[model samples]
Target chain A: MLLYTIYLVAIVAEAMSGAIMGMRRGMDLFGICMIGTVTALGGGTVRDVLLGHYPLGWIAHPEYLLFTIGAAVVTAFVARYLHHLRAVFLLVDGLGLVAFCVIGCDIAMSAKMHPAIVVLAGMITGVFGGLLRDILCNQIPLVLQREVYATVALFTGSLYVGLLYFKVDSSVAQLASIGAGFLFRFLALHFEWRLPNFNGDRIRGFE
Target chain B: MLLYTIYLVAIVAEAMSGAIMGMRRGMDLFGICMIGTVTALGGGTVRDVLLGHYPLGWIAHPEYLLFTIGAAVVTAFVARYLHHLRAVFLLVDGLGLVAFCVIGCDIAMSAKMHPAIVVLAGMITGVFGGLLRDILCNQIPLVLQREVYATVALFTGSLYVGLLYFKVDSSVAQLASIGAGFLFRFLALHFEWRLPNFNGDRIRGFE
Candidate 1:
């Protein structure tokens, strides 16, 4: 029940994030709503698709769209004041990332996916919403380019799977993974942790 | 069978196009293969996922990966000589676009989707691959911005549906749609036709 509540909160946060990006880009109302919904639901949708699991989260629960759309519209009006809440926004977003990872792992595990794929699915759910958001915004995906954000997802998923393997109770595993993942992300943000990127600008002959 | 052959050729062409873009972006070998495969298969994968179709095209036909990966690797090696065949490349790409549209339509029609959605599926199959490729390349999707490319897919799909409604032979409809779609794309390219984009830079208050 708590995870479900976190999931709802996460979608709203992601939608607001998308709405802010769209407003910054000068997109129209429909584009803003579309981007917001995609950012909110895109990760789960992609994870489901990759695993051949379907009826998609939004399709089965249409009210999720209403939540995302409403959040986006509201954000469009109050964006100027949002900077005051930036810290709160970041914390909630990080929390959502861990929740998404845990939820994604549950789906893959239920489907009997390989452990590696289950973790991959978790990482996809945690980060792909923002990846899709960046793509629509016409920018490099921040997670792929640098940030240790994806590392947190990998760690969370792996930890959850490891705990389950060691016979930890499911609920305990979920809470433990989510807590650790959130802490990891928070520390990474505080410390400005980043992954190493190769010299992508160094145009050598393709090797 | 004709459509199947065209599908193979299309994937190869799309993969090569992706490889060239990745190479130009100074992406490494793994990046090149990943981009190439995504470009070649992303549209159909997205279509099936959206439609809630299971088992996905590439999952069922793992050999498709071989085709795309092989084409990408080959292109990386022979890319310098490719510009001389730009016209040929363009033709094949256009042809592939049409073929993809027809195949997408057939799948949706069989799934008993609405006529509008069927047409949409075709357009998605035709353009989303390139849209995704542009996303990974970190640029605005060209088709969404300016090209009449999506228009051709729409037209081809509508014509195919209409012809089938009037009891046209299946083969006749397929050939007719592909021919018209290819011609439309070719002319659009040659004449430099474009769609209008609103002033995205004119940042008014969100409306």
Candidate 2:
């Protein structure tokens, strides 16, 4: 139940972020809705597809699509005011990251997948939607470029999996993992933390 | 038997094309291989997942993975030479497009999907691997931007389905559809046929 609530908040925030990107690209209303929906749901869709979990999350629950589209249309109309609320959306997006990671890990674990795959699944679920959005908008993905975001998902998922392995109560494990992930992302953003790039020449050559 | 043979040729050509793009982006060997594999198999992977078909094509047939990766690596070493043979590759890519469309339609029909969706399935199978490739490489999808590319798949798929509906011999329908799609694409290329864009100002506002 707690997880579901947080997931809702995260998806809405992500959808709005996607809409802002679409507006930046001057995409049509149709394009804005397309990007927004992909941003809000693409990660879960990819995760579900990878895990072979049938009846995809959005397909099964059409209301999520409505919620995402509604958020996007509202964002399109009010984009000018969005600059003022950057901090608030960042906070929400951070929370959503952790929630998405936890839920992803939980789902993978329930499937009895390898522990390594479970953690990877969590990270993919937390980050791939934004990656898809950036790709569609013709930009390098921020998760791949910037600080500690995908790492936060990986860490939280591993922690949750560890706690469960140690017979920790599920509720305690969930809260602790979420708290740690949120703090990690918040600090990374505040301090402008970044993963060290490989020597510039090699990094540029590959990236 | 004919379909399988054509499918093999198509995947190899697509994989090589993906490798060329990777080289243009100055990507390392891993990136080249990743892009190539995605270009070769991504469409089929996406189609099966959307249809809730388990054991993705590449996973079920590891040999395809090996084949795509091999093609990509070869292209990386021969990218300079690829430009000299652009016409040849273009011809091969066109054939592959039709093969992919036909197979996609066949699979969807076998599953007893809606007729409209079957056509869509064919288009997705024919075009999405390239879409995924372009997205990962950070470009607007050519299928969406170019002349008469995706349209060929749509026409071919619809024709195949129509023929099948009228109880045309499966072999005859397949051959005719493939021939029609190939000819349509060839003519479009030769004539520089393009779907008309919306008025520039209005398109800029929305597209």
TM-score of each: 0.61, 0.61
- Candidate 2 structure quality by residue, lDDT tens digits, A23-64: 666565545665788898899888988898766677557678
Q: Give me the runs in candidate 1 sitting further than 4 Å from their true place.
A: A205-207, B1-53, B57-131, B140-207
Interface RMSD of each: 5.7, 7.0
How displaced is residue B145 in candidate 1, in Å?
A: 14
- What's the C-alpha lDDT at position B202 in model 1? 92
Superposition-based RMSD of candidate 2 using all C-alpha atoms, in angstroms = 6.9
User: How does candidate 1 fare on TM-score?
Assistant: 0.61
lDDT of 2: 0.85
Residue A199 CA error for candidate 2 (Å)? 3.4
Scored by CA lDDT, what does every candidate get?
0.87, 0.85
Residue lDDT tens for model 1, B1-207 = 888999999999999988888777766555566578889999998899899887678756768888998998888777877777788888899999999999999999999999999999998999999999888988778788787889989999999999998999999999999999999999999998988778867988888
- In terms of docking quality, model 2 is incorrect
* Chain B TM-score of every predicted model: 0.97, 0.96
Top-DockQ candidate index: 1
